[model samples]
Target: MSLAPRVVIVHRTTEYEELVARHGTHGQAAFFLGSRGRDIEEVAERHRRTRQALAEVSAAVPLTWRQARVERADLDRFLFAPEDVVAVVGQDGLVANVAKYLAGQPVLGFDTDPGRNPGVLVRHRPGAAPALFPSVHARNTGADELTMVEAVADDTQRLVALNEIYLGAVGHQTARYRLGLEGDGGVVEAQASSGVLVGTGTGATGWLRSVWQERGSALRLPHPSEERLLWFVREAWPSPATGTSLVGGELAGPAGLRLTVESERLTVFGDGMDTDAVELTWGQTVRVGVCGERLRLVG
Candidate 1:
């Protein structure tokens, strides 16, 4: 017989937990915070709410179904099965954090603190999981197939993200690369700047929005469900050796952006997770485009 479908619950370490870990005890953490004119109760309250939501979601899993729980730090090591249903119990960012690891499995996002979170991805409450479980398991529930972005190096090293992928220097130093748009008679430019950012419509509201707002309507951002990707070369510096004409544009249909590494080394990371990034050496090339995988988020 086939195994029961698994429900994977995902969460992150709370601020309270981090504080305690850093200070060695709750009392010490509280004292450290109090010394800086902050209150520990606020952090503790958030921790309590997150814990309660996790417990409630765990209890809501059907008795006959298999279940698993994982923290954000451990996601890189966790293997997800094809027949799994993911329950993200935290904020909307947590949902994004887990998106790159999944492959079309239904993701039900639960907002532990609705008042604090934006409720974009994690729109449901813990109490709603019980009523939604049956429909989700049957694959009859409504879902949004959010578009995602991907970057693949010449060596076949790849990275994916729900929000955005950044290719830049390992530190704060300027990055050097040759940027090109792949298509008929595409243009290429040798540039020195902060870095490059490629993002999806689902990310239009986050980091990409900040860059868009500053550029003032040069390009239109795509919708969350749209199969489109946007690219921007951050703070492109112009000089005799470097041109800035090919700075930003959109990738629709089969169009893609390519980057040839000119610096000693560059780092590529997705969704702001720099620790887990792909490193590129000089003369190496990487391509950024819309990923074939989509995030099937349960609403």
Candidate 2:
């Protein structure tokens, strides 16, 4: 007989904890809130709700299965086995953070505040967790398979993104790179722009959408589950050495988008998190493509 699936709850730090960590003490946090015309009680209440929800979620897990709790900060170091049924007890972004580490495992997203924070990814509440196990365990759970983007630099550092990947200067300065877009026939263009954004259909409504809105493209944006990817070179400038024609397009199939670093320094980060990024020096090449792994999100 097969063993029970282990329930792994991934949670992030609460608002109160963040305030205390930033201010060094609860008293200091209160003072800072007061000075900003904010009530410390609000933060306290938010933290209270978060903790209560987490407690309820923990209690809801059935005793038949093994359970493990992982904080968001420790996700990178956590080992997720194939049999693990991952549950995220935080905001929507937390689901994205945990998605990259997973290898086709079923993810349950529980929002701490479902009223104020209605999430697309984290659609379920803590109260629903207990009832979800049977279906999840039987592998009969309804799920959305969200496409993810991957960025590989010099075949050394590789990072997967559920939303979008930003490739540019660390500070959003002008980024210089040889932009290569793969189509029926490969086309490479030397260009200077703010940066490049390679996003999945899951990210169409996010960063990619904003970029498209600003530029007003006639092409249709990708749907959440689409295997295709969209690339946009922000503010591509016209120079003697740089071409602006191939600023944006769709990338699919084996040959994806490639970037040869021409700037003194450039960094590739995913999901708008810069701290976790790959810094590329001049002449380094980074490839952005669709990640084979898909996020099996149980709504």
Candidate 3:
């Protein structure tokens, strides 16, 4: 007989929990929020709802299957098995947070609070887990293969994300690097700017959208299921030493955009998680492109 699949339920610590931890007590947390003209009950209610939803999802796991619970902060340390089914019980961003860590596991996104969340990735409610879990385990469910972005450094450091990847300096200062696009002739430009951002269709609805809006209709962004990637150089500074000719473009097929670090130190982070970024030194090259591993999202 085949081994039973493990159900990994993922969630993040809510604002109320964070506040209480920081303040050392619920009353202190309430007082802190009150001073800011905010109500602690609002945060507590959301937290309560999220916890309740998590409990419901957990209870829906099959009796024969192994179960695991992981917090967002512990995802980096979690070991996901090949036969594991991931159930994310949080907001849409939580789904993105957990995507990079997964290989090709089917993910079921659960929205604890409906109206508050956009329900883009987390489309289902907690109650749906009872029916959805069996379908997902049997591989009889419909799933969307969402594209993801990846960044690989010369040193073999690799990072993948569902939304986008950011490469820039470690501090507030401008990042200096040489940019080149594969298959776009031998042309390359040295640039000084805020940094570089490469994203997928899923990312277009997030940070990539802001950059697209700023440039009007310069390039068409891809959809969530499109097998393409978009890249943009933020605030490309033109000076005697650097050129701004290579600002932005699309990456398709086997092509990738390359950035060679010229600054003392640079960082590559994905999905807005700056603390877990890869560090790069001068003379190091990092390539950004569409990732081969797609997020198998079960609707």
> TM-score of every model?
0.98, 0.94, 0.98
246, model 3: CA deviation in Å? Answer: 0.8
Model 2, global lDDT: 0.86
Q: Backbone clashes per model, in order?
A: 0, 0, 0
- For candidate 1, write residues 24-133 as lDDT tens digits: 99999999999999999999999999999999999999999999999999999999999999999998988889999999999999999988889999989999999888
Candidate 3: lDDT over CA atoms? 0.93
lDDT of each candidate versus the true structure: 0.93, 0.86, 0.93
Error of 2 at 186 (Å): 4.0
Itemize residue pairs with steric clashes in candidate 3: none
Residue-level lDDT of model 3, residues 158-201, one tens digit each, is 99999999999987589999999998897889999999989899
Candidate 2: list runs displaced more than 4 Å: 1-3
TM-score-based ranking: 1, 3, 2
Candidate 1: segments with Cα more than 4 A from true spot = none
How does residue 152 of candidate 1 score in lDDT?
96
